[model samples]
Target: MVRKKGVYGIAIVALICFLLIVFCTKEPDTVRISHNFQAIEFEDVDVIGEDISIDKIIDTQRLRLERKFDVFKFVTNKTFNKLSMLSGGQPLRTIIVTTWRSGSTFLGDVLNSLPGNYYHYEPLLHYGIMQIRGPPHADTAIKTLKNLLNCDYTDLENYLTFGMSHIYLFTHNKRLWTQCEAYPQYCWNATFLNEFCRLFPFQSMKVVRVRLRLIEELLSDKRLNTKVILLVRDPRGTLQSRRHRDWCPGEPDCDRPDLLCADMVSDYSAAIKFNKMYSRRFRTLRYEDLSLSPYKVVQDLFDWIGINVHPEIKEFLDTHTTVNVGGVSSTYRDSKNVPFHWKNDLNYTEIQSIEATCEEAMKLWGYVKTKGPKLRDFNPLTSYTIK
Candidate 1:
């Protein structure tokens, strides 16, 4: 009986040891790890171990692992809400917000052309897409961008727009995703969007291209010492240019021209309203001024940004400043010698139609009324073609 009892006790001890081993071997379901300016989240971790310190995993391999984990977190969350929270919320240097087709792209391209400037064209679009589809989509966007540019991130970062450069230019698309009825939830979530914008205010300059409507939001960022460049053009010309783009309304190529027109009008009205509200903040310039006096405008812009034009930049400007009408392949046409094309291109009827369609916008922007013989009728269909 004594021997049997001893054997039973040993068996019980073995069972307890087995259970302990099993418990120790089980992996954690989630682990939150943070490192320099970033936090990594790991889910479904298989190894059950004591919590690891970020300091202990500061090497290259660990950093790569952390990045992978971050990608996973981004996918799961489908938002960049936590990015600002990491690194004690480091602020971004600059944010350049603008409406689409308002020479923002040209400005971005020009800024990026300058050395030592980081100009990201439409980064918010990528960010928005990432927010919608998660990390895989973000990765795909990055990869596609890299491929389209025919350069890797390392090479691209050398220029002023791809990475954390000293000078950053961000051209944010003004159209909120929520406007699309199909994806109301994807519209700019103020919390996340504000957080994203707030992350970059520490820079030396935040040059914002303020359309009339978004000035309020631009003003709300008290941290940002905003320099507003209010860009304006004739509503008729604006619509004409807009219609020429493949993405514009009334384009035969567009799947829904009616919706595009409504959206454009809404956007134009918002711009007009914004301009009225923040007229004092703006250094208003006509699109014609930029075209006719490229050098003067560019020099003035440089002064505003507090950058001395390097000799190389000046030389490039001197060569490229002349107006190259009829697309990029055309020869430089001296603005002084060339007659204004609008006089011939825009008929009386077309002008009146444009005025009628965007009278509020024109009045808000301080456009002067012109006297002319009224033409019989205006047909926008004949004036512009979608490329």
Candidate 2:
């Protein structure tokens, strides 16, 4: 009887090991590719070099494990949620907060590619440019933003009537304008507002010119239901790009790299504070990370924002994000190459100047300072593909 018991125990142990191996080696389930998926074909030689596999692009083991977990969780949760249709009344309101030259435009464009998206670009920019005391004013700006969230144009129209051309330039949507053209005053009226609100429930605003402190204050307001995407770039990269654009080349304070670095430190400090206060509602996106893996980064971002990664968006990234600067006949640069270009553009002194003030901020945001011109580790050249 004892000998039989030992044999049974050994068989059970062997069975458990066999089951573990089977489960561990099994391939993860793949989501069916929707017919709506679009592929963007590009002829640019610079953008079309040896294709990097998506697996190679996402080399971080931690990130890969998280993504794997997310896939299982996402599938299960999504299947459960599909039992009932989600309502448009409670659409996700997103605020993309960033500083100048932080690639907010690129990120915004990707988010805006989603259907039924109402995008307002830099609504507070006019306030800064016009020296208007209201738009950036916490209460006033918050009120205007609330109206936008509710899809109301009454207050926005009144504000624009003050000859705020800059406001019009940024906030105006050509498609909406065309749709409202037949309406009185070209659909800048109540009926048009109602229809616009009904048609496009999801709203997004990308703000770059606003102060981070004011944004924090606005978000702190419980009445405003919005998620903030704090988009950040390495100070070295942002400053180098700004220098290329001559955005503050002539201004003495702006020309001083140290001052800019200090400002970046302040900005990132505010970001860290805001994130701490609103961890769930506030998500941060780094330009460097996004550049290295656009599809993966975007997938994770969309998942975090309670949305599914749509196929059209993937196509949009391929088509719009990868392109040459000007006289765009064929030549184009891959979007992945956008990050770390500062390495080539900025000199040692410039990088060091940025590092002096932004060291803590850089570390806080997962930016590692290089000992030399380039990072010895973390090579982006890897084979990967996202289907």
**The candidate that achieves the highest TM-score relative to the unseen native structure:** 2
Lowest summed lDDT window (length 10), candidate 2: 40-49
TM-score of candidate 1 relative to the true fold: 0.43
At residue 266, what lDDT does model 1 achieve?
48
Q: CA lDDT of 114 in candidate 2?
A: 62
Quick one: best lDDT, which candidate?
2
Question: What root-mean-square deviation over C-alphas does model 1 reach?
Answer: 18.7
Q: Give the Å error, residue 282, model 2.
A: 1.3
Candidate 1 per-residue C-alpha lDDT over 102-144 given as tens digits, one digit per residue, 9 for 90 to 100: 4544444334334222233444332321121234444444343
